[model samples]
Every structure is written in structure tokens, then in C-alpha cells.
Target chain A: MAGRRVIPGFGLSLGFTLFYLGLLVLLPLAALVVKASSLGFAGFAQVLGSPQVQAALRVSFVSAAIAALGNGLFGLLLAWVLVRYRFIGRRAIDALVDLPFALPTAVAGIALATLYAPQGWIGQWFARADIQIAYTRAGIVVALTFVGLPFVVRTLQPVLLDLDAEVEQAARSLGASRWQTFSRVILPALVPALITGMTLAFARAAGEYGSVVFIAGNMPGQTEIAPLVIMTRLEQFDYAGATAVGAAMLAVSLLLLLAVNLLQAWTRRKLGGA
Target chain B: MAFHRILRSFTALALITAALLTQIAGCSSKDGDTAQPGTSLTLLNVSYDPTRELYKEVNAAFADDYRRKTGIDVRIEQSHGGSGKQARSVIDGLQADVVSLALGYDIDQIAAKASLLPADWQCRLPCNSSPFTSTIVMLVRKGNPRAIRDWGDLTRQGVSVITPNPKTSGGARWNYLAAWAFAQRNGRDPREFLAALYANVAVLDLGARGSTTTFVQRNIGDVLLTWENEAYLALKEFGADRFEVVVPSISVLCETPVAVVDTVAMRHGTRNAAEAYLQFLYTPQAQDIAARHGFRPRDASVAARYADKFAPLVLVGIDSFGGWPQAQARHFAQGGLFDQLYGGR
Candidate 1:
């Protein structure tokens, strides 16, 4: 088999990949699914259908989506700056983008909470305006955005770096405006990478707990997130209910990610075939 | 060629070093597990947060007293976290020789789930095995800017409150019930009062310490609903001049219970030491230590000595709500009263 393939050890490498993924990812998820299945389909639906659980899921998904959209806009601008411009501290800025990935999420949460609490340094300004940030839904979004920023910026950097400036020059030569060049020529090429980055960010933010919990205020059916609801159930020793909610979250996340993937594929086929 | 050979040699050296380290770790852990007859014994006391300081003093004093009396050197180890989380650890087999958790329900969980101890473990010791007790109190900013005097004041609009999530913090459960008791005692609808109280909460942190941070360090809320000891702790930690504790007219009596895990203790052959360690907590010396750490000592004389330290208040015990099991099921459970009340907003 090794001799037959252009790349050696096809069978061995594929086996290793499967084993690694199965051990690290699929095993725990399979256990979660098994535990969740104990609730049966009806019990699972009832658990997720509860008003509190519904509210929590809405908070988690909506905040994660908003955070991901914010990341997509800002992350693209950041990656573009690093790739297309020559500036002092460019390398430092690029390295700084990975800080969120390195810092413990609890630390980021505490820091964010302290910085955004009503009387905090940044929060004081908002307070003067009679606007609350920490202990509100806005606070969860802030924490999620902090955690998911690196995912977007890191994902887009490579693709942005590889994008040729000559393509923009070619569009300019053909009497296209700057916006037209970016929208028609440059943007279509970056769409797939942007979607991938946004999806990764959304997935990360959706599952975030430690950072968001500190700032969430955690009012049920209000600021409460789905992860906190699972934690609450576990605290009550309702393992079956906890896993039921978790399984529902996992299924929904999978569906959303799959849709994004399909959209990415469609964009790739349209552009690649052209 | 020489670089590749050097890298290979280093890789082999790393593997050899890793193997050697694991062998040493295995040997040391094996040695620490067994209790030899006359030399020394080990007991792991799994506890909850806010008792860290109290236990530190108790552990040191008890260790000295045990060595002096029995001449068998006893070392007590400790593991602390959120109450329910610590209980879950014991249930999942953390080998806790004794568990001195924040509430009765947590210990009850160990009995029910793990069978590590008898279901009647609470009756095994005096005072339901709670050597010291605490009550829910309000910690307010200095000068009481909001004019917050009681549980009723907490529900007032424009008065931000800070308390942990009852689902996560044992102390928060007591806080919630304390407010409920106060409302009932005042002849108002308890559920509506609770809903209003939580409506004013600025942050529902996961534990007592986190809520203290929100109230003290971050300065987010107008008041902090917390354990009596925790309120005092915040005053001592952040300077008494910055905050003051208000003993509500009525509050819930927080009974933090302890017990020996029969299975773990018997297996380790440290049952005697574990029982003795808990027994030591009831002594005058340990009770005094508990008082200094801001807990209301169960010892009458010790509590009297510190009576001036704690303000007078009517404290309703867990029995008022049909004990922890019923209270836990009614209030803190999923879609229970806490969820129902807080979810309304």
C-alpha cells in the first residue's frame, strides 16, 4: 500500500489520525451521548424545552453569534493590516494577537470583570452614561469576544499573507474602483477563510464558561448561559438532565457548523471553478 | 549527519529521564498511602471555601494536640472548593477520609451516591456533627449609603445587591433562605420578595469569595449577601473602614457538617485518627479558633466570649424548611423555587 501511494504510509497515517481523534475527541463525546441518551428522546426534548434552558441556549447562541460577527470584522482588519502594510511594531502586534490563547480563561474573565464592573476603570465611563456593561448580556459578549478574537485573527492571517497584491493591481488596470476590486476580486477569494474563522470563533465562544461566568451575573432566563445551566444541574446532582441539555447544545452546534461548512464549500466551488 | 545523531541521543536521554521520574513518583505515592502502627498516619479532609482560614488554625492546633495526647503523629491534609464541587469530588472517589463540607445536603449526597459512609452520619456526632455555625448577613459599603437596614432594603429599587448563584454556592442557598425567612416573618409574600431581591443583584458569582470580590474589590454592588464569617472576612481583608456587616433581623442558621467516610477511612486504616481529628474540632481550643476565624462556635463559653463580635439576630435553622433535603429539592433544584423566582425577570 505504501508503494502504491504517492505519499508513503497512507494506511498507517490514516490509522494514527483516526486513533488520535477518537481518543482525544470522539471518546468523551461518545460518553456524553451515551449518558444523554439515558434521558430518552422525549426527556431530552422536555429538558431543552424548559423555559430556563431555552433562555440559556438563546443567550449562549446569540452572544456567540454577535461575538463571532464582531471578530470577523475586526479580525479581518487586523490580519489585513499585518499582511498588507509595513509598520513599526507589526511583529509585536502579530504576536500580541495570540495572548488570549495563552492566558487562562479564568484570569481573562476576572480581568474583564474588573475592567468592566460598574465602578471599574472602563466601566466608570459607561456608568456615567447610565449604561451597565459587566453583569449584563453585553458583558458576556465582551468576554466571549476576548476569548474568540485570536481564533479569527490567527485563522485569517495565513490566507491573508498568501493573497497577492498583484491581483488588486490587475483589477485597477482593468478600470475597477478600489471598492469594486476589493468586493469583486479580493473578497470572493477571502470568503472561505473568513467563514472558517468566524465558525471557529462562534464554536469557541458558544462553549465558553469560565470567562463568561464571571461577568454574566447569571440570572436565570436572563444573563444565564447554557454552560452555566449544565453546571447548575450538575450541582443539583441531575446528571441525566445536565447531559440532556449538553447533548442538545452539541446537536445544534453541529448543525450550525455543518451549514457554515456547506456554505464554505459552495463559495469554494463557485470561485475555484471560475 | 552529526546534528541528527545529537538530536536522537537527546531524545533517548529525555525518554530515560521521564521513565525515571515516573518510577520515583510511583514509589513515593505508595509509601504515603499506608499508615504504619506507631510512626504516623494521614487523613484527607475535603472541605469547602470560606473555611480555609478556620481549618488552617484548627488543623495546626489539632495536629499538635493529637501528637501530645496519643503520641501518634497525625497529619491532616485538606482539599477545598465550591461546596457542591467538593462533594462531587468525594462522590467520584477522591478518597476523602473525612468531609467537612459547607452544608448537610452535600454530605448527604456522599452517603446516597458513594456509600462511603452511613446515611445517618449526621447523627453520629453531637450538634448534628456541626461544631461551629454561621448565619447569613449583609455587608454594606461604609456609611450605608443606600440606607439598607434589612432584607426589605435589599429589594428596594436602585440598591444593587451581590450574592452568589444558589445553585453553585452553599452559602448562597442560606442567603436565599435567610431572605425568604425574613420576608415571611414580615408578613409579605416570600416568593415576590425573593424575586425582587434577586432582581437587584448585580452579579451572581459562583462562590462566596467571588461575590466578596464583586462587592469589595470590584465595588459593583450596594450590598453583599454572604455568610457571617465571609462578611467579617471581607471587612478584615479589605479593611473594616471600607465595609460593615449588618446582621439582618432574621436569617438562616448555616450548619456546616463533617463526617468520616467509613469506606475510605477503613481502607486506609485511619478511622481512629479521622474520628479523633473531627472530635478535636469540638474542643474549647478549636472552638476558640473557630470564633477568631469569625464562625459562631457551638461551645457556649466560646460563643459567649465572642458574643460582642457577632450581632444579635433571630436565626432560623434548616429544620424550619424541613431540613436540607427538602429545602434543596424545593429551592435550588432545576425549575425549583430559585429558578422559578429568578426566571420571572
Candidate 2:
């Protein structure tokens, strides 16, 4: 009885799930791996070991991490407001969160680049302060943050809405401070959702090219992203080299995502036990 | 929590389904259009960045001319992007009946990699299969406040040069080589001169149009090193009062080549139409259209008619550096001269 499932046709659904993922994701990844492997192990290592590629990868990974962490914090606040409060134009505000998702990324990148150029309205203020945004690593972060925001917000919205306010009230009634209520009573349950949201945001930002290309200064060793490095290789007609970089990105992304999943599962188990 | 999980999965599934549906629709829509070719014909012109306006006029004119000549309605579909990218698409099964890329090396690549056309495809047409030509030039703010006139002026301390990455832009490869040619003609070390010039570059946009935007729209760079036509287009599109074109003392001749993909054209039964279309580019009528669009016409009459539009310079052909293949391998290839220019520092 305990093992009996409420949903029927488990095997059929599971087969469909595998088929869908195989066709959409695994097939392309397999092709990439095959192309990258054609270069041989030494050739692959040589392609990935270049300093320019290394710098680009470092910039890409670090910026994506920063962008994801930023989205996680701000997205939490946004989701909290949408779920916790009712105000004038709340529905509009709720719909506004999806604009980043709806707007074409290239258009978003162009708009952001225009807004952040030194002569631009927002950038002129920064220019006065002698701080550059567009054509810098900071600009890459800004574009990534813009594109990844919706991922964090959409992922957290449901989890935030499902969060019971009674738990916080009960904790406060028991003489716990507000911070205590948040940190002790509420945060643990939100931990899994928050990590999942951040992971999604991180993944989205890591693979983002359309929005970052226009904003990134694209100096080979300085502001270039890993994806741009792949493109540069492709432009030179180095198919194997391009796939080598792509395979590296894929492996790194998979490992990071796997780590995040394990972390999420551990937190869920720990919470369930607690 | 269970309900939320289901909702999230449903949304993901729906998005995936929608994407697949669109993909199917896109594929199916292009499938049968060429099956029965008598009533109407389609020719796909895979081209590069700045040729959008040029081909827009050419394609319309050619469609009309073809219908009048053959009594068959012809629709020429145009696809434009970075030169190398467009070539790569054709190699990767884009089914283009004709390719008018920004450089011969790109067409050579399609021939070498895909074998869609013969190795001597350029010899198939006149003027090395280049119906038109252009030269690299400097675009500066009106009055030329920086007084940037030549390649040497671009490397000056205060002049911020805006040019696309050579690896991505066919025009930029010409820009790089023209600068190299200038250095060589002046007996300066080409590599050092290029290093200094790149040091003055404000941004390395991915393509020619992007660099034009960086210079003209974003107002970042002091001077833009670009194809002459693009510089002219920038002035014509964005007010000429704001900027001016500076013809350098020496520049590389950019012979944008056109070729019919023999295999694809034969497969699509568009061989005759495709060949005629390319041949039409050499006509005086089309040469006039090319001149108006800022391209240097091959026809002497058309070129003389628009003489003032193009400034005279010692135009160095690609043959001066062996050819496109050798030049590309030495300069734009991985660990080559262009990469070495900005590599370590």
C-alpha cells in the first residue's frame, strides 16, 4: 500500500520523459561530445588551456555566479512582495516580472547597451563619477542579471506563495525576534526553493550570449565570455576547437548543476528530518 | 508543494512543446515551395552583413527582370549575417542556391568543406567572380577634428578606432590587411603598427554593422575603420552633417564575390535562374544600382558616373599577400598575427 502510486502508467510516462529529453537535450550533447572527441584528448586539452580561453571562462563563470547571487536576493524580495502584499497595480507588477522572459534577448541587450553607454542617460551619471558600465565586466553582469532575473523570480514565486505565514506568526508569538523567525522558522523551508532558483539563474546566465555580446567589451583576454570564445573559434573555422570549448562548458555546467541538485536534496532531507 | 511541482513541470513541457511545434512549422513551410518550380521559383541568396540594402534592391530588380525575360515569377529569398557565419551555414546544410559572401575565402570554404561547388568556382565568372569592389576607409566626426587621414593616424594616442573583430567580419579582415599593407608600403613593422592601432580601438564589436553602431550611434569611437560602402551607408543613414569619410592613402581592395552553389542549385533545379541572377549583377543597370548603394561598380561607365562618391587610393588587392587562403591562415587564424596583436596584454 505504501509503495502503490496515485498516478497511473508510471512506465509509460517515464518512457515519454526519457524520449523527450533524449531527443531535445542528450542528442545535441552527444553530437557535441563526438565532435569534441574527434580532436583527441591532447588536442582538446590544448584548446581549453589557452590563456585567452581561460580568462574568458573565468569571466563568464564569475560573472554568472555574481549575477545569479544577485538575482537570488532581489528575486526573493520581489517574489515576497508579490506573494505577501496587495497594492494598486499589483497585477501589472506581477506581469512585469515576465517582461525579461518575453522580450527578445538581443533587443534587451541592445536596450541595455544603449542605456549604459557612457553618453547614455543612466551612464552619463556614472561617467560623471568616472565609472564605466557598458564595455566592461560590470556590463556583462548587468546583462546577465537582466536575463536571469525572470528565472529566479518565476522559480521562487510558487514556493514563496506556498510558504505559510502562520509559521512566522507562531514563531513571533513564541517570543522569537523577527530575524529569528525568518532565520529559524522560515529560512530552512525556503532554502531548497532559493537554491533551485539560483541554480536556474546561474545556468541561464552562464549560457547567455545574445544579451552579453552587445554589452561585453569583448576584449579577448578581458571581458570576453566563454560563449564568445566558442564563437571566435567557429569564426576561424575551427569546428573541433569550437566543440572542445563547448564540451568544456557543458561538462562544467553539468557538474555545477549536479552539485546544486545534491545540495538541494540534502537540504530537503535535512529539513524533512528536522 | 505537489501542486506547485506539477505546475512547474507543465509549464516546462508546454514551452518545450511550443518550441518543437514552431521548429516543425518552420521546416514544413520551406519544404514544398521548390518542389514544383514552373509557376514560381525561389532562390536563396546567403550573404553577409552590409549587403542587406544592396541585395534588397538587387533582388527586387532581378525578380522583375527574370519574370520579364523568362515569363516565370521568381522570388529571391535573402539571408544575411556575418560573412564567415553565413558561409558556415551553407556548409552545414542551409540549402542556399546562391552565395554572395563578403570575401572569396568564405566561398572557397564552402567549396572546400561542402564540395557544393567546384574548386575553381571563382574562375567561372568575370573579374574573379567579384561583380563589385570596395576599399577600406576611415569614418570620422565632421570636420575631422582629430585630423585622422590615414592608417598611421588611427594609432595616435587620442584616436579611438572602432572596427569589428576580424575573425567575425569579412570587412574587418580587409581593414586589418589594409592597415598591414599601409605599414608595409611605408616600411614600418606591420605587426607593431597593428598592435598600436588595436590599442586605440574602443570596442571590438562582432560584426561591421555593430561597429558602425558603436561609432555612429553610441558615439564611442573617434574614428571607424570600415569598408567604404559601410562608412558611406553610415553617413547616408545617420546624417552626413555629423560625420565624414576619409579615404586613406592606401587601402585593401575588397572584392565581394558572388557564386552559385552548383550542387544546391542543381538539386533545387535553380541552376539557370541562379547563374542568370549572378550574371545580372555584371550588367550596367545593376552596376548603377550597386554604385548608388555605395559599392564600387565594376562597369567603367557606372563607376565613372559615381566617380566622386568613391575616393581614389592605391588599392591593394588580396593577391599582394599571396591570396585569401594564405592571408587568412597567417593573420586571422588561431595564434596568428591578429590574435598576437592583442594576445598577452
Candidate 3:
């Protein structure tokens, strides 16, 4: 097997990867599935069909999607700015991009909640207009956006740095306008990375608990997120019901990410072939 | 170079794995030492939030008394969280020798789920096993800008209220029941009153401390529904110039219950110490300490000594609402009054 291998120690590395993945990821997921199955199909259906559960799932998915979309656009602009331009505090800004990753999620939740509460520094202005932010659906989106920002910015930064400026120069030398050059050339080149970043951000936001709970008021059927609902069920000592909700969330997230990855792969292949 | 990179990565992974294994080993070895015969005994007291100060005083006093009496060095470890969360941790094997929680229902959950104590465990101590009691009171901004004086004022349109989620917080359950009791006493429909009052709630925090932070630090709501001790603590900590305590005309007596976990105490062979520790809470000295810390002492003389500190008000007990089990099932359970009030919104 060693003689036939294209790479040396492939067997060892593969074994290590499988062992680590199985121990950390697959085993816990399998346990969750088993726990959920104890509820039976009808019981699972009943858990998902509850109006409060349905409302929480909607809040989680919709707010996560909006946050991911916001990150996609702003994150690309930030990556482009950092890659293509030199500024006074370029190194400082680059380091700051990873702040969300280093900060604890609960701290971020509390900070965000404080900053957006009605009497807070920024919230007082919004309060004047009678538009509430903290303890509302919009507050959940803000916290998710804070935690998910780094995924997009960090993922696109490397890709943006690798992009050749000569391609854009050539487009400019031709008759293509700025919009056409960006849409036809630069955007197509970045689509695969952008989608990857957005998918990661969306998945993270969907499962976020600590940050959202602090700001989300947690009014059932109004601002409660799916993860909080699972926690609430667990607190009620309804383990099977909690796992059933968790399994449903896991299935949906997996399918959605799978679809996004498939799209990214297709785009990559077409561009490479072209 | 590729082989060197792989080797370096594997070395790092091995170091991380070794570190994690050592931590786990350290935890198990510590657990093993509890059963060994020794002159010194350690007990874990799982309690709810807002009782940290009260317990700090009680534990220190108890430790000194125990040392003087039995000459046994007793170390009491304290764990605090939302009462229901604390109870859940006990049920999930937290090895709590005693549970001093914000409400009796939380202790009842542990009784039903983990068999830590029998269902009639509350009968072991006097006053339904509640050493000290508090009541639901209002904390308002200084000068009472909203002029909110009673539960009815909380339902006014422009007044925003702050309280925790009842499902997760034992203190919030008392707040919810207090409002219900007040409404009923006032000849108003309890359900309608609750619905209107909750509508005025700008935020339903996860626990009592979170609600306090929202009301005091963040300054979000016009009024806060919280435990009587918590209100006084906020007033003392934040200064009377910034906050004021309002004793409503009628409120529910928020009894904080203490009980020994028989299974845990027996397992650790610390049953005697655990029972003695709880029994100590009922002493006149401990009751005085409870009163000084803003709780209504159960001991009549100690309570009278601090009567000037607490305002006079009518307090309905949990028995009037058919006890903890029925109240828990009817009011705070899923699809109960709480769910109908907030979920329907």
C-alpha cells in the first residue's frame, strides 16, 4: 500500500482524520439522532408542529439569512479594501477583523445588548423614533451579524489577495465599463469564495444561542430562536422533545449547506473549464 | 519539509490531547477523595441567584458555629444560578448535598426527577422548609416618574415593565403569581390583568439578575418586578437617589426553600453535617442575619427587630394558590397562563 500510494504517510493521516472526526462530530450527532428517534415519527411531528416551535424556527432561519446576506456584501467590500489599498492602520484593522472570534459569545451578547438597549448610547436615538432594537427580532440579527462577520471577512481576504489585478486592467484597456468589468470578471471570479463564506456565516448564525438570547427578549412565538427553544425544552426535562427539535434543525441546515456547496462546486468547474 | 510539517502538527495535537486527559484525570481523582474518612467535611450547597450575599453571611456564621461546637472543619461550597437551572444541574448529577432555591417547585422537580429527597421532604423543617421569606416588590426610577404604585400601574400603556421569563426563573414565577394574586384581590380579572401587564414588559430576561441589570444598569424599563431583597440590594448598590423600592398593596410571599438531598448526603456520608447545616438556618442568630440582608425572617423576634426596614403589605402564601405543584402546573407550565400571556402575544 505504501509503494502504491501517491503520497507518503497517507494512511496515517487518513486514519487520524477519521478518528478525530468520528470522536468529535459523528458520535455526538449519532447520539442526538438516537435520542430523537425515541420520540417516534408522530411525536417528532407534534414537537415541530407546535406553533411556538414553528415561530422560533422561522425567527432563527429568517434572521440568520438576513445576517448572512448583510455580511456577504459588507464583508466583500472590507476584503477588497484591505487587499487593494494601503491605509494608515491597515495592520490594526486586519487584526480587528478577528476580534469577534476571540471575544466570548456571552460577552459579545452582553455588549451588544447594552449598546442597543433603549437607554444605551446608540439606542437612545432609536428610542426617540419609538423604534425598539434590543429585546426584539432586530436585536437578534444584530448579535448574529456581529459574531458571523469574521467568517465572511476572513474567508474572502485570502481569495481577494490572490486575485490578479492584471485581469481587471485588461478589462479596463478593453471597452468594458466599471460595472461590466466587475460583474462579468471580478464577481464571477469571487462567487465561489463568497458563497462559501456566506454558507459558513449562515450556519453559524442559525445555531447561535448565547448572543441571541441576551438580546432576543425570548418572548415565545415572537422573538425566541430555535436554539433557545431547544434549551427551554431541556430545562423542562423533556429531553426527547429537545432532541427532536435539534434533529430537525440539523437536517435542514445540512440540506441547505449541501445545496449551497453543490452550487459552489458547479460554479468552480464552469469557471475552470472556461 | 512536508514530513516535518506533519510531524509538527502531530506533536501539537498530542500536547493538546495530553492536556485534556490530565484535566479529566484531575477531576476524577478529586471526586475519589470525598469518601475517605477524615475530620474535615465538605458540602456543596446549590442555590439560586440573589442569595449570594445572604448565603455568604450565613455560611461564614455557620462554619464558625460548627467549628466551635463539633470541632469539625466543615467547608461549604456554594453554586448559584437561576433556581430552575440550579435544580436541573442537581438532577443531572451535580452532587449537591443541599439545595436552597428561590421556590419550592424547583426542589420538587429534583425530588420527582432524581429521587434526591422524598416528596414529603418539605415537612422535615418548620415553615414548610423555608428558612426565610421575601416578597415580590417593585423597583422604580427615583421620584417615581411613572407614578407606578401598584400592580395596576404596571399595566398602564406608557409604562414599560421588566421581569424575567417565568419558565426558567423561580423568582419570576413568584412575580407572575404575585401579579395574579394582586389582580384577584382588587376584583379584576387576573387573566386580563396579566395580559395587559405583560404587554407593558419591554423585556423578559432569563433570570432575576438579568432583569435587575436590565432595569438598573441598562436603564431600559420604567419599573422592575423582582424579589424584595433584590430591590433593596439594587437600591443600596445603585444608590437611593437613582432607584426606589415600592411595596405594593398586595403581593405574594416569595418563600425561599432549603432541603437536604438524601441521596447525595448519604453517598458522601455527610448526612449529619448536611442536616445540621440546614437546621442552623432556623436559629435566631441566622434569622437575624436573614433580616439584615433584607429577607423577612421567620423567627418572630428577629422579624420584629427589623420590622421598620420592611414596609407593611398583605402577602398571599403559595398555599392559597393550591401549593407549588398545582401552581407550577397551572401557571408556569407549557401552555399555562404564562404561555398564554407571552406566546399568544
Scored by TM-score, the top model is: 1
TM accuracy, model 1? 0.93
In model 3 chain B, the worst 10-residue window by lDDT is B29-38
Q: Please provide, for model 3 over B58-159, each residue's C-alpha lDDT reduced to its tens digit, 9 standing for 90 to 100.
A: 998998898788777789999999888899999999999999999888899899998889999889999999999999999999999999999999998889
DockQ of each: 0.49, 0.43, 0.48
Docking class of 3: acceptable
Looking at model 2, residue B241 earns an lDDT score of 100
lDDT of 2 by residue, B60-88 (tens): 99989988877777899999999999999
Task: In model 3, state the lDDT of residue B109.
Answer: 88
**Which pairs in model 1 have colliding backbones?**
none
Candidate 2 residue A116 Cα shift, in angstroms, is 0.8
Q: Candidate 2 lDDT, tens digit per residue, A61-114?
A: 999999999999999999888989999999999999989889999999999999
Q: lDDT by residue for model 1 over B172-261, one digit each (tens)?
A: 999999988998899999999998988888778899988998889888889999888998888888898999888779998889999999
Instruction: For residues A2-99, write the lDDT of model 1, one tens digit per residue.
Output: 66877666765688799999999999999999999999988887898888899999999999999999999999999999888999999999999999
Q: Residue A81 in model 2: shift from native, Å?
A: 1.3
TM-scores for the candidates: 0.93, 0.92, 0.92
TM-score of chain A of each: 0.96, 0.94, 0.96
